[model samples]
Structures are given as C-alpha cells and as structure tokens.
Target: MSVWFQSTGRKMNNSSEGQLDKICESLSQAELVAMIELQLSEVDMLQSMFPDPRELVVEDPSVLCDLRDFAEGRTLLLPPHLDLIINLNVGKGRLSMSANLPHHYPAVQPNIFVRSQTLNRDAQHRLNQELLGYLKMLQQGDLCIGPAVTWLQEKGETFFDDHPEEVTKSDANTMETKVIKFARLWIYSHHIYSKVKRKDILDLSREFDLTGFCLPGKPGIICVEGLSRNTEDWWHKVRSWNWQKILCKKLEENELKAEEDISKYRRFSVFEELGSENNIRVKSGGFHVDMGDVFKYLENHESGYVFKEYFGISGRAT
Candidate 1:
C-alpha cells in the first residue's frame, strides 16, 4: 500500500477516494505506475526486516562488560579471580542477509577493535584481515547487529539510581562484576598480587587493601580499593579496636614486672657493696657486687665462674 504524509509529519486526508485519485494521477500510465508500486513494496519489506531497538540478555556478565568496554573505546581488565571467558563478538556485524534471513550469527556481535601501535607486519596483516572482514560484511549487507546502545543506556541508569532495589539482580548484579573486571586493576594486570590458596579463586584483597564483593553465582570477583596510599590517613587513623586495647594493657603489666625486678636487684647490690670492696662490681654504668666470686668462695673453690651456683630466676643473668 502507498502511504503519504503532510509537511507536519502526519497522515494526509483519510478519504480513500481522494487518495486513490492522487496516486493514479501521479503515476499517469500503466507500466511506470507498476514499477513505482514495486519499488514502494521493497521499502515496506525493508522496514519489516530492520530490527526495532531492543536488548538481548548477555548471559555472561564478564562478556557483556568486555563488549561494552570495547564499544566505549576502553581496554578490558578481567581480574585474576575471574577466568578469561570467550564471548560472541557483539560489535561488528554488517547490514546484509542470509538465505532469506538477515545476516546474523549467535556469539558473533558488534564491537570495535583497536590497532596496536607496536604491532609487526605479520600482526598487522592479521588485524587488517579481521577489520576488513568487519567492513566487507557491512558492504555486502550480510550482518545485522542487535541493539547494544539501548542496553547500555538502560544499565547505566540502573547503576546510578538512588533506589537501586527496584532493579532486578540480573540487571544490577553485573554493575559490580564489571567494576572488578575493569578497575582495581592490580588483580587484572599482575599475577603475583593474588595467589590461589585453595581451589577457589581467593581475593588477596587484604594484601592490596581492596574490598571485593563476588557475584552470588558468577565466577568473577568485583573489587575496589577502599583505602589507597593517598587516602589511608583518613581511614586507618581510626581509634583502636578492643583487642588492641587488651594488648596495650598486657604490655603495661610486663613493663611494671621488669621495673620490679630491677628494684630488687638494686637492693641486693647495695647490701653487698656495703659489706666489702671485693663484693663491688660495675655493670651498665651502675655498681654491683661481684656475686660470682662470693659464690665460689662459699663453695670452697669448687667452681671459679660460679654462674650456675649464683643463678636466679626472674630477670637474672646466668
């Protein structure tokens, strides 16, 4: 059916007789009108084949993010806690069709790829091959990509929403996963920063002073550096915990006991010094009785050093 509109972008007069008369006069003769009508029909068919903007659920959160990041012209940094997963390309399909079906492939989606500045000729050839393939498909109208733009717009709104509870887990859950997958990049860039202690992928979060929250069922760990070197003073300057207070009390008790031992030793040394010069000795800038000589004399010269004979517990030197 032929349709026309007014300058204001609405349907023209709805009277069928007037519309038919207009179309017939515009076409004039038979053959020319038939061709024009056939061309209009093709356009109508094209509109039906074109997709209305909609989102397909990205089953894998990690893949979903990687595709979006690529679209945004950013690098993907998956955490060590998250396994490297292969996903259907979501950003490079063309505008063509297959045997009656539009050119589309599962796991093959639209995306952008950047060329490495330092790539060798051979590497460049491989890259060119892939990029050319992307362009060629579009030229031949063989690739029909899904609506990633609308999907990202909806997700971004969900993340920044103050009332986040309204968003379902399937929608909001990926927000955190994408964070760990892309930010707190140590877990993504280096291997030594995190090590697997057991079978599960553990977040060595404490080592990096990171706070990681893993998805309920997904394999990736989302982490953020709650406290970094620049921001540490504001956080760790907090008051001590209960265990720290207990430790301080124990240290005070030990210090008092050490002081008591020194006092008792001082009293014994004073008494010995008052008795005779032979009993006097100096240690650590203070006077002390030569208790070793006195002990040997008492033992009738059986032992000269008398360290064992003069032994005392509780801060005594042997």
Candidate 2:
C-alpha cells in the first residue's frame, strides 16, 4: 500500500511541474510585452514634448530606427536601449541633460547626467546629488525624467545662489599684487539671452576682481577692467563657451603709477547688469539698448569715448 501511494504522488508531482512551466512561460512573455509597451510610450512622449531635433538628440541613431520599426509592426524584436540628450533653457540658465534607458526601464531607474555652463563645480555636484535623492524617493516604475526636468527648471537656480564660489584670502591678496597693469576689455557677442552666460559673466568678474557692466541684448556687450592677466584669463574662459559669434572688440591697457588710485582709472566700481531701467528694453527675441542711455552712462563714468570705437559713431546721434 505504501508503494502504491508513492507512485501516485510522483505522477501528481510531474503533472504539477508541467503546469508550472506553462504558467512561468506565459508570465515571462507578458512581462516582456508590457515592458516594450511602456518603453515605446515613454519614448513617444519624450519625443513629442521636445520636438526640436536639436533639443532632443539621440545618442545612437540606430536605436531610433529600431524603435520606429518596432512601433510600426515591421519587426517582432524589441527596440534597443535608448540614450537621449535634452537641451533645456531653464529660467535664466541652460541645462544639458543625458538620460539612459535600459531594456527594462520603468522597472529600473535611468542613469542621468546634467551639465551646465552656469553652475560651478560644487554647485553642479550638489545639483546632481539632489537629483539622485529625488529619484530614490520615486517608485521603481514611475516615469522620472519629466519630473526631474521640471524640478530643474523650477529650482536649479537656487543651487547656483546657494553655492557661491569661495575665493581664499591668499588668492585675493595674490591677485591684487599681480595688478601691475590696468586693462579694460570690451567683448561683443551676437546675442546673450542665456541666463547661464550672464551668471558666468558675473561670477568670472568677481573671481578676477573686475569692475564693469554687462549689457545683455541682441548685441551683447561686456566690459571688464582689472589686472591685465586676470582680464585675459577671464576672456579666455568666456570665449570658450558655445556662441554664434564673440569677439574682443576693444582692449585698453596702461601701466599703473605708484600713487594712482585704481578707482579713479576705472569707470565702474562693481560688476552690474544694465537692463530696461537703464534704457535697455527686451523685445520679442532679444534686447534693444537705447544707445542714448548707454552713451549717457558711459559719459557719466568718463568712458563715453568707447561709443565711437564700438559703433564707429561719435555719439548716440549716429
């Protein structure tokens, strides 16, 4: 009787194993289908939101073709993993975001990297850390890139303000001692609508102890006067950024006298942004500076002669 019961138990176990295999196979296929659908939907949404080719660039062009084929039912194979870069014009700043989505994403979080021209090293690190923290708080299957971008557009500027670059006392003293020659540089750009560029201009001026003003608009104008070497270094850094066109329009250098007050030789005491109140108006795309106001400001500071050098005109009349 024991042998009979044992034989029946073995047969029952074999039948259960066959049924379990079928169930597992079914579940695996369903999971794969679901994953594919999720990925396709997300990619479509992302592409739709950032319609510009420049704004949303695909790292691997083949992946885009594969996705297209799969979506159109021309292939049974799943689309390849996707790597995307999104260029964003966040509130007065610019951000370049890279997102990598694996085969099982939405089931897993994407790897993300954010780059900015405006943020300093420490600020960049803090921004990335906070973004990682934000991802951790989200559910595993939740879509995060959109929210991440929203967070950046809304709060990224805070990080810039929060992490002010520090200049050591020794560095400041060294910079002061290095100022044997006083120099002023006038830089011109096609346009400067980016807040990131503006912030960088401000930060670099502070680092170099430059005193000047930036007129941001259709024809962006920047003037920085300080130690010759520092001004050169600052210009080198600024010109390296992506721009339609940028040029050192004018350069003025003079040897400092022993009793000369740097203040008397400098037109501006601090770096500042000249805006609408200063006769610079924002039009649909860029800024329009009433040359009269600019000439007036420069004339007040005894630096009005630059108008002729910059515009080839004697004054605002021309």
Candidate 3:
C-alpha cells in the first residue's frame, strides 16, 4: 500500500504540464476501488451537505413526483439553491431557513433566524412555521413505492429476496439495456425508539442502498425503477435457481467493512468512544505488518460504524 501510494504521488508530482490528468486518473481508480471494496456507509455520507450527483439531481416537480408520490400531499422539493440556518434568539433555539436566487449559487445572503449575533422575531416565526410544515410531511407523507409485495397487503408485485449467479446464453442474448439501480438510506440516529426527534439524533447510523435494501426482510419501502431502461435484465436473474450461491458471494465476499489496517490498528480508539466493548472487538489475523512513518499510504478511510455493520446489514431489514 505504501509503495502504491508513493508511486502514484511521484507520478503526479513529476508531470510537467501540471495538468490534473494524472491526479484525476488516480482519483478515478481510487473511487472505483472505494465503490467496490469499501461499499461506503450512506448514513455518514449525509452528515454534511453533499453536492447531489449530477445525474441524480432532480429539479422538475414532475420527475420528483413520479418517483416518490405515495399519497396526495404534494410536498414541495426544495431546490439545491436554498440553504437552512438556525436562529436562537427569535425562534427560541429553532432553525431558520432562507433562500437567495443570487445571480451566483446563492444570490442573496443567507437570512438566518437563530444564532449568537442573529435573532429576529418575525423571521424566526416564519421559519418556524415552514419547518413545522416539513415536519408534518415527514411524519405523514404518503409512501410512494415501486414493484409490489404481499407484505404490505395492497396487491403489489413479487420481489426477489436474493440475486442469482448463473444465466443462459440464449436469455443473455435477449437482454435489451443492462442497468439496475440500488438504494442506500442515511438515517440520523443513535438508538431506536417510537418517536425520534431531529435535535436528539447524532447522525445517520447506516444506509441500506439500492438492492441492498430490496431483500424480503429489509426495511425499505421505496422504489428504484429503471428510468429509460427495460426490466428484462432485472427480471431474468429474478427466477434463476442457485440464487443462494450468488447471495453468499455478495454477502460474504463483498462485505463493506470500514477502512482500517488490521495489522496496525490506527483508528481503534473510535471503537472505545462509541461504547462498543464486545461488538467492536477486532480479530487480528495473528500475522502483523507495520509501516514506520508511512504517510504516503492511503487506501480508503472509513467510519468505524461501517466496520461494525460488516456482518449485520440485516439489522436494518424488517
């Protein structure tokens, strides 16, 4: 790992044009490795505002509605341009959201309602009302879903509990477009309870993304349809036999453990901090290796909770 990182860095620093081609190339490789190896946690990804994926960003109401409209309530999808802030004085420690159609990304200044130096009575109340509306939507929003299942007892379609491993050549030839989108949720919370409030939450613990949450016992009731793609590729493997082998491959081999050097535990302190005495225990493979002052070594940094979920992705399932 040290050699690989050092080599990549050397190649980038030696470039004459100083162009980002080499650096970008390395990043692309790193990203692909991260996706396949790390299978990153969704819960932690949303701790900060993340720039929406270019392809996934939806600005049109129709697009958003068609994807997630469960009931009749039309909760407006806030544009990426809008920003939220907190005003402690006026709204009594509540959050205040303001918008700016600034010629730039944020044309207008962020008018916050709560803060140390910022406190306006009317503005705080207006923001409070708006937040209340969102809370209502979150609490009672109609649940729009895709494909159906007998679980909900609403007469839906059948779903696959596991992915298949093998397929026939004749069937593969009939395939149209090959694409399947998965889902991952970022739930912000420390423990489970009847009513979970925002301020009490720490952060999203885990994310059951895409097909990961589509299992029979999974907690996801969401939809992930192929936009312009056909459903043939998805349906073929649905009924194929020997599905358990494929599942074993995915679950065992493709475990999304957090990034940490097993031989030399650097981030192990996080385990103690989370109050994990037994569950967070590490099983060192006996053989050990260490790097003295290896600053260049970088594979993928991961949240400790992700490692904790290594064999327990089923916890989020119903």
CA shift at 42, candidate 2, in angstroms? 28
TM-score between model 1 and native: 0.13
Backbone clash tally (model 3):
19
TM-score, one value per model: 0.13, 0.44, 0.16
Write the residue-wise lDDT of candidate 2 on 211-283 in tens digits: 9999988778899998776686567557645466788889999988654777767878899889776555445
Worst 10 residues of 2 by lDDT: 1-10
Per lDDT, the best of the predicted structures is: 2
Better of 1 and 2 by TM-score: 2
Better of 1 and 3 by lDDT: 1
Candidate 1 whole-model C-alpha lDDT, 0 to 1: 0.26
lDDT of 1 by residue, 64-167 (tens): 34433433446433211111111122233211111111001111222222122233222333443444354444422123222222222232222232433654
RMSD of each: 33.1, 19.5, 24.2
Model with the higher lDDT, candidate 2 or 3: 2
